[model samples]
Target chain A: MLLKAEKITKQFLRESRNTNQFCAVQETDFTLEAGSFAILTGRSGSGKSTFLHMLSGLMTPTSGRVLIQEKEIYSLSDKDLSAFRNQHIGVIPQGQSALYSLNVLENICLPYTLYHKNAHQEEALALMEQLEIAHLQAAYPSELSGGELRRMAIARAFLRKPELILADEPTSDLDDENTKIVFAFLQKAAREGAAVLAVTHETDVSQFADKVFCMKAGVLTEQNSL
Target chain B: MKLANSLPVRNLKGKPVRTAVLLLLTTLLTLTVFGGTLMIISLKTGLHSLESRLGADIMVVPYEATTKSNLETIVLQGATGYFYMDNEKYQKIASCEGIGQISAQFFLASASSGCCSLSVQIIGFDPDTDFTITPWIKKSYAQNLQKFDIVVGNDLNAFVGDTLTFYGVDCHVAAKLDKTGTSFDTAVFTNSETIKALIQSSVDKNMNEFKNINPDAVVSCVLINVAEGYTVEEVLNDINIHVKKVKAIQTKDMISGVSDSLSGIADIISLLIAVVWIAGIIILLLAFTMSVNERKKEFAVLRMLGASQRKLAAMVMQEALLVCLLGSLLGIGLGLLILLPFNQLIEELLNLPFLLPSAGQMLTDTIAAVLVSVLSGGIAVSASAFRISRMDTALILRGEN
Candidate 1:
């Protein structure tokens, strides 16, 4: 298994009530094999995003554990966990995730530069060309359209070519054509031996998934592939 | 570590207005701290130099001179005025009990000294009996002054071997003295013979106040040094009681007025510095806070990109450090620009002595001021860096917090 979650759960304390707690995600066990594409679908407030945040090691699970390549990720220190994620996993966040100050090309190189390493400019430009944002390399995020910005975010996540890819609403702002383009890219990443998990509301996303899951009211359930 | 060429600099460049405001605030803070401190130190140094240049225990001036002119204005300031008592008083003061050394000084003003726009005070001291001027003059001139040989003060336009015509009598400048930031800096010093000849020339020229004055058998003031066992007050009292027309004033008494004025000015400057620091810190704190609050989502995105909490905090601090470094150097440069060129004007405006310290001491002070400026900037932004580093990344990324 490239990624595994064993009975993971998340809870939030209601700010107005000191003694009360609300569970955002509940008792979820999941696993993904190498070179597999998984699609998670749920409505708003269904905790789909919350579950992905836990699996990606951005939030510590209230119970249970997440293991990536059989190493318990949350068991490591915060600094080590951050490094682990940078080297092994890529997360594409929801809306407006690009740093406004950096141009599109520089934004794509942020993962390398964050560790003070030299960026691979040739690889970054090749990825931008593949995503059709090569012409907008010098443009800042504010000058980009919703669809173009989403494509840039996708290209940035693939820059490091991580073993695991977690994306939230990857095609939320795209039209039908751009949506199909981004889904094909995610499927390609999985075929190249990466475990890719994408969360979306679009039912058509199931056509590209090797496995599918549904989240509703903080509870997760698996569904047969389309 | 390579922060100068990092995202911090690019971020600052992206938002030009915020960066400019921060730089301007830091600049003002350093300017006030460095410039204000330099002025206060210069005033204190000037006072010390004035006291050292006087180098006398007591001055016995004509009683009429004290009543007619401010003693500080005449001694510490190079205001042109003359008063004389009969030479009998000098002889009497010499024989007084516990007298260390007594020197008679002659005073004359040139109508048009050809050196300055205004008349300059020419002071003539008896070389054999002088205790005040001889030691300092020896540093520049080894030989005793001849009849026409003159040593000009630091502020004078004449140098060594230069001819200074005072009241139509050509005098040779033997040497120039170092600056003392006192009236001595503007006065010319020579032996009694040369001053007498110059006075006689002035009388022959029929200059105002030079007529009807006999240069013979007269001395303007007597500089006295108390013996080791004698107190200055005791000697001053003796001179005042036994003497008829002379008033003996202690050197400390002559400096008290200027010292009191300087104290008031120092207090005002200190208060202004405190206020500037408080205001600068508050402004910077608010600036950092507002800037961080507006970019909460950006910080969250960075966190999502696998930047640790410490890295985020370091980025904020790096931006502040770069801004402070540039702003403080510019401020020190501005302070030097303002203080060095207008030092004479500042001295005149304040009516107090102003002397800057040596170059090495000043450079050390500049470094200290720059460090303080940068440190204060760090302090001002510390709260923001901490808060943003600890913010909830998931909540911010979800756009809920």
Candidate 2:
């Protein structure tokens, strides 16, 4: 397995609420195998994004362990964990993830720059071409449309060619044609032996996944094989 | 990546207005610090120079000269004036008890000199028995001063080999003395013979204010050092009581007024520096905090993209470091441009002595000011950098903050 979660849970304190405690994600056991595409579907406030953040090593679980490549990721120091994430995992965050100061090309090459390595410009350009954003490489995020920005974030996520891809609402602002382009690219990456997990409410996303799951009221359940 | 293409540099370059504002704030901070420090140092230096150049414990002047405050005005305020007493009075002061060393001096004033349009004070000393002006003048001109050869003060507009005409007598400039940062820098120094000739020439041209006085039989004032076994008060009392027409004054009493004024000005400059420093740091703190708070999502995105917390903090500090380093250099440059060139004007305005420190001292001060400015900038941004580094990345990305 490329990724696994065992009895992961998240709780937040609510000072104004009577209970004074809120569980955003209940106990959950999950695993993602290599070379497979998975889809997580849920309503608003269903804790889908929270779960993805935990898997991406961004949010710590209140209880339980997250294992990537059979090693507990949260047990590592912050420096080692960040380095591991940079080398093995790529995340497509929701809602305008571009750095704003950087143009589209530099944003796509940021993962390499962070580690002081030479950016793979050829790979970035190819990904941009595949997403139909090649012509906008020199444009800043503010100058791009919503659909273009979403496409740019997709291109950046795939720049490192990591083992696992976690995308949160990656296609929320995309049009029908651009959404088709993004799904096709993720499906292609999965075919090439990268485990891809994307959270989305789009009904058409199910067709591109090998397995589908649904979340409700902080509870997650496996639905069916696509 | 090269530093020019680094994320922090790119961020600052992307927002020109914000970068400019931060740069301007640091510039103001450094300007006040460097400029105020240099001014205080110069004032202190000038005061010390004045004290050393006075070089006498007791000065006996004609009583009428004290009544008119002519001696004080000429020595402390750089005003040009002359007073004379009979040679008999000088002999009486020399014969007084508790006197260790004594020298007689003659004074003359020129309405307009050869080198400039300003009136100049001409002081003549007896080289054979003098203990004050000769030792100081020898630092610049070691050769024995001839009858008409004069040594000009540093502030004079005359140079060595230049001839200055005063009261229809031509005097050759032998050398120019170093700056004393006192009224002495504006005077002309020559031997008693040359000054006597100038005095006689003034009387011949009807320029002498005191008519029917013989130039050869009169002296301007007597400078005295107290004998080692006696106090200055004893010598001053002996001279004042024994002399018929002269008043004895202590040099320290004359300089006390100047010292008090210098102390007051130093305190004010120090207070101004403290206020500007405190206000600058506070304003910088607020600026950094607000800027970090406004960019929560951007930093959150970097965190999600695998930037370590340390990296985030370092980037913020790097921006501040760049601004402070550049701003401090600019401020020091501005300080030198304004302070050094207009130092004379500043001295005149404050009516105090002003001298710049040596080149090495100035260099050390420059380095210290830059380090202080940059360190203060670091301190100002440290809190904001820490807060941003430990922020909740998930919530920030979710737009909850």
Candidate 3:
């Protein structure tokens, strides 16, 4: 197993006294194997993205532990956890995630440079070329279209070639053709032996996913395995 | 090429207007700090130079001359006019009970002689009885003044070995005095013999007032140093009572008016600097806050890409430092351009003695100003850097609270 979530749960305090607690993600035991493409489908506010955030080490669970390659991620210090995430996990966030000051190519290369590591330019360019954003290499994010920006975000996640890829609504604003390209790229990442976990509302994502899960009202359940 | 270049530099380049405004504020802060501080220092230095140049407790002048001329113009402003008391008056003042050192000085104006472009005051000191100008002139020239040998002041156009004509007589310039930012800087110094010759030549030329003067038997003014335990007022009163037709003036009384005006100007400059500093820091705080706040999402994105909170804060600080460094250097440059070239004009406008610190002191001051300006930027934006760095990445990424 590349990732194992053993009885993980997240709770938020209710601002109003009418409610005792708000559960963003309920108790859920989930495991993802190496070389597997998984999709968790849910509508907005369904907590699928919240679950993915926990798996990516972006949030701490109220209880329970998350282990990647048998190493508990949350057990590390904040600095260590951030460094581990940088070297091991790649996340494609929803909405406008690009750094406005940087161009498309610089944005894609940020994951490596953020750690003060050498960014491999030939690999980044190859990825941009594959995503069809090669011509927009020097274009700032503001100049990019919704679909083009989505592809650029996807390209940035793949720049490091991490062992775990977590993408949230990566295809939300992408059109059908661009959506196919992004999913194909995710499937290719999985085929090359990386565990890929993506959250989306598109049911068609199941066609490219090896394992499909559904989250409704903070409750996660495995639907089936491809 | 690695596409990840310095992000802060690019950020500043991206937002030109915000950067320019911040730059301008930092520039103004540094300008006021450096220029105002320098001006205050120069004024104080000039005052000290004036006091040293005066180097006397009381001056005895003819009462008729005192009626026509203010003590400040004759002593501080280097105004030239000849007024004489007999050698008998000098002898009486020298024998006063509290007198420590006494010197008799002669004054002759070269303005009417038409040997120089501007009105130059010619001061003739009795080398034997003089303790005032001779000791200062010794710093430049070791040899005593021969017949017409002269030591010019720092501002004079003549150099050592140059011929300076006084009353159509060629006076040899033996040496030059260092700049003191006093009237001495514009005056020429020589022995009594040279000036007596010049005075006689003026009378021979049939000059209006010079024709009536007797340079041999008269002394222009008697400069007196009071004893250590005695007061200038005591000695001045003694001279006034004993000497007939002579008024005694204290050097301190001559410069008190200038001191009061200098204190007022110094206070105003200090207040201006305080206001500018407060305003500069506030402006910088606002600029950084807005710039950082607007990029919350962007910073969140960087965090998600595994940028540590420290790295995020460093980026913001780097941008601030760059702006501050550039702004301060430009401000210092602009200040030098204004203060250095127009120093004389500034002195004239303020009507105060003005002397700049040495080049080495100025260089140190410039470095200190730049460091302070840049450090201020860091201090002002520190809170913002901390706020953004410690922001909840998940909440920001989700675009929610």
Candidate 4:
């Protein structure tokens, strides 16, 4: 196993309108083998995105040890941990995830460029080529269509060859062609030895991952094995 | 660092419309500030040098000129139009107790032609014993000076020949005075007899011009020299009480009064302009704060990416510094462009034979302008940076764009 997120719990502090604190995630134990792909499925406000945030080192779980090769990312200093997350984990947000400041090539290369990693322009082009939009390399994120943007976002995640990829709603609202392209890339990344976690409600993307986890309220439970 | 480095100056690449608006306002603010500073400095330096070269303790001109505003127009410019004393009164002044050597200068006017309107000041003095004018007089035609011979101030001699008609009488330019860097730079000088004769004839000529029955007017303003131990005020009071019709003013008093009067209206205008400039700086602060606020999401994302609050603040500060640096630099360059043309225009009109930065005031004004721009920009960032650092990362990550 390359990562273990065991006994994860998260509580969100509610404002004075309710004057109450509520747990968003509670005691969720999870394990992922190297090169495994999983889909986290949940309804709105069901804590699926919260769990993915903890797994990606973007947010800390109230209680848990999320270990990537036995290094607890949440426990590291702010700078050290962000560096670790940028180096080893890739985060892909929902639709319109691409930063407009970067062009198609720069958007795809952002992961490596922002972290000061050695740049490989050819690799970013190759990834975009696989998504069938190699010709759109110079296009801005705003100029691209929904499908082109989603493909570009996936390329950014895969650019650095991160050990773990966490994407939120990887193919939500995307057309069927884009949906297939996104799923195909996620599966390929897993097969190539990266742990991939996609949080989604879409049934089409859910079926593509090797394993699945379901969340209700603030708790996670095993739904299937690969 | 890498983000800013990786992108073209964001103004060039960022939302093009917003960048254009920002650049326009920044450029206007900078130009106004830079040009305003140069004008102020130039005026001050011009006046300061004027005060420094006046070789007198007290200048006893007519009270009408001194009592009026300091910028009162006078033709007391060169040695050619010098003032002669009331003869017995002159002897009385030389005899006064606590009095030092009295250097009496007699005026003789010379026109380019006997008919030309252009006139120059020709003053006559005793070759020895004159303290005020002799220190810088160089030499006074050392070999000999007769009634028709003259020694001219530097630039004045350069124009007229060795023999120019003074009071319609021909006079020789015997030798010359060193450059005085003063209004007197265009005056001619000679012995008392030459000047007295010239005045007698000029009176005769003006009497002929006006067809006056007697001399039109006898000389301009008389200058009094005081001993080293005596202050100008002491001599002024002594002359006021002892001498009749003539008033005495200390050199230092003339300068302060002149500066006050010369810049009085300008000071009022400068104050109003200064307020406008201050408003400009405040606008820059508001612009910078708004600019930073617009990028709040971008900065929050950087913070989420593990950039510390300090680093994020530095990034914002860097943007402001660039704005101020560019704005001020452009303002200064623009100011120089404006000043170059304007200065030439002023120098031509005034001929400023001895111009100094209008009076001791140029430097302070320029410094105030640059400070307003940079200090405001720096303060604006500091005010907003603290609030930014406290922003919650999770909220930003989930917040609506």
Name the best candidate (by DockQ): 2
Q: Estimate each model's TM-score.
A: 0.96, 0.96, 0.93, 0.80
Question: Using lDDT as the measure, what is the rank order of every candidate, best first?
Answer: 2, 1, 3, 4
lDDT of 2 by residue, A124-187 (tens): 9999999899999999999999989988888888889899999998888679988888898899
What is the alpha-carbon lDDT for the whole of candidate 2?
Answer: 0.89
Query: What is the TM-score (0 to 1) of chain A in model 2?
Result: 0.97
When 1 and 4 are scored with DockQ, the better candidate is: 1
TM-score of chain B of 4: 0.69
**Model 1: lDDT to the true structure:** 0.88
lDDT of 2 by residue, B1-401 (tens): 78899889998888788888988988888888998899888988998888778789988889977653556678887898889999999888988888899999999888798786799999999998898899999899999999999999899999999999998788999999999778888999999999999999898888989776788999998999988899999989988888888889898888788888998998998899899889988988998888888788988988887889999899899998898888899889999999989998899999998898888878988998899889988999999999988999988887876
Poorest lDDT segment (10 consecutive residues) of candidate 4 chain B: B207-216
- Prediction 1 TM-score vs. true: 0.96
Q: Which residue pairs show backbone clashes in model 3?
A: none
lDDT of each: 0.88, 0.89, 0.86, 0.66
Query: What's the count of clashing pairs in each model shown?
Result: 0, 0, 0, 16
Q: Which model scores highest in lDDT?
A: 2
**Cα deviation of A169 in candidate 3 (Å)?**
0.7
lDDT of 3: 0.86
Summed over model 4, clashes come to 16
lDDT for B58 (candidate 2): 89
Candidate 2 stretches with Cα past 4 Å from truth are B67-70
